[model samples]
Target: MCGRFSLYSSYSTLSQGLKLPLEVAVKLTPRYNVAPGTWITAVRHPTDNEPLVMDEVWWGYRPHWAKEKAPEPINATVEKVATSNYFRGAFAHHRCLVPADGWYEWLPLNGKKQPHFLCREDREPIWLAAIWTERPDGKPGCAILTEPARGVAKEIHPRMPLALDAESLKPWLDPHLTDRETIRQVVHHLDAELITHWPVSTRVNRPTNDEASLIEPLKP
Candidate 1:
């Protein structure tokens, strides 16, 4: 349900926050229409001893088994990803983190969807639980996983992005720890209290608008 999100932080801020190695980065200007198919940054922890690393990847999933031409599925369901063949392979090999300042969901209105902006009161960036893929000849791609919405997210969307913290994220990314019990503990439990929501102007509905006013609170 996290169709759109924002990353207003600078490259160094993100690098420091995620503890990543420096690499050539595609300029990350402020965005308000970060939809599917675009390149995005994800952080990963390869080993317990190594530092977390952030790198850019596409924001969609194209399973190796899919015969269709479409190569990027924007969303993945956490409940079925572990068991589904289309996702199980990537689940084991391509775990990642989708960092964001916040996310956007929409409320159904008179034949239109009105957007709402959600953020942590801390005003800090959050890391979404994500899965990814790497093609032999293409840019690495990823998908944001979803779980049943709770807290403020429930008011706008039935399902919300699966978000994780340092503790839970470690287990989720460790390929060798792929067991039912471990995945169960990380996937089933979540932290929703870290979020707050506000109604925003309908300008966010348009994919072309990338202004700050899109997240501004609507006056009564």
Candidate 2:
């Protein structure tokens, strides 16, 4: 369900990879163990006719109109996001891209769960499709979209974050492209063949264990 992920790429690298303008002033600290409910980087068109901007957004979604007690979900399933009453508004109008190095999934092995890191085979940054909205507190909150896992990711878990192909990023973030069917036609997920996964230290299970070693392959 993409509950944990990593985004340690430098600003320059993310800028080049995501085609972000140099003037978008935002500072980024490398995070190897990003968890739900924390602020995370996302690229979006904040308003009509506005250029795309990269900024931090709380990694949980609760539409401003929802009751204060409404659940703030971190991941929204693609199957229902387009029609769900709680998510359709943001899905149609507040699409964003979450840049990450990779995401973590746990597999039940023996009597315990083993954590695995899933990433692009080329080691390039991945842009996860997401939607955001203004929360009651006036802060932007977002939820990463998830779909049925494909290829190697299916082996790790039944679902995975919807990582977009490079060609789909701009269209996915286009504020004017709000029609659900057209969005489905113009946007597509990254090819499953490009994804790879490997077992990693369980240290990632604890959100505070942020470090380079957390992503390194665990020794056999």
Backbone collision count in every prediction? 0, 0
Error of 1 at 27 (Å): 4.2
List per-prediction Cα lDDT, in the order shown: 0.74, 0.93
lDDT of 1 by residue, 24-88 (tens): 34577777557776777777654435555666787778755565675567888878878787788
TM-score of 1: 0.84
Minimum summed lDDT over a 10-residue window in model 1 is located at 17-26
Best-matching candidate per TM-score: 2
The candidate maximizing lDDT is: 2
Against the true structure, candidate 2 reaches a TM-score of 0.97
lDDT of 2 at 78: 99
CA shift of 3, model 1, Å: 1.2
Clashing pairs in 2: none
Clashes of 1: 0
lDDT digits (tens) for residues 1-220 of candidate 2: 9899999998788878877452454688889999998999999888857878888899999988999799999999999999999999999999999999999999999989999999999989999999999999989999999999999999999999999998898889988898999999999999999999999999999998999999999999
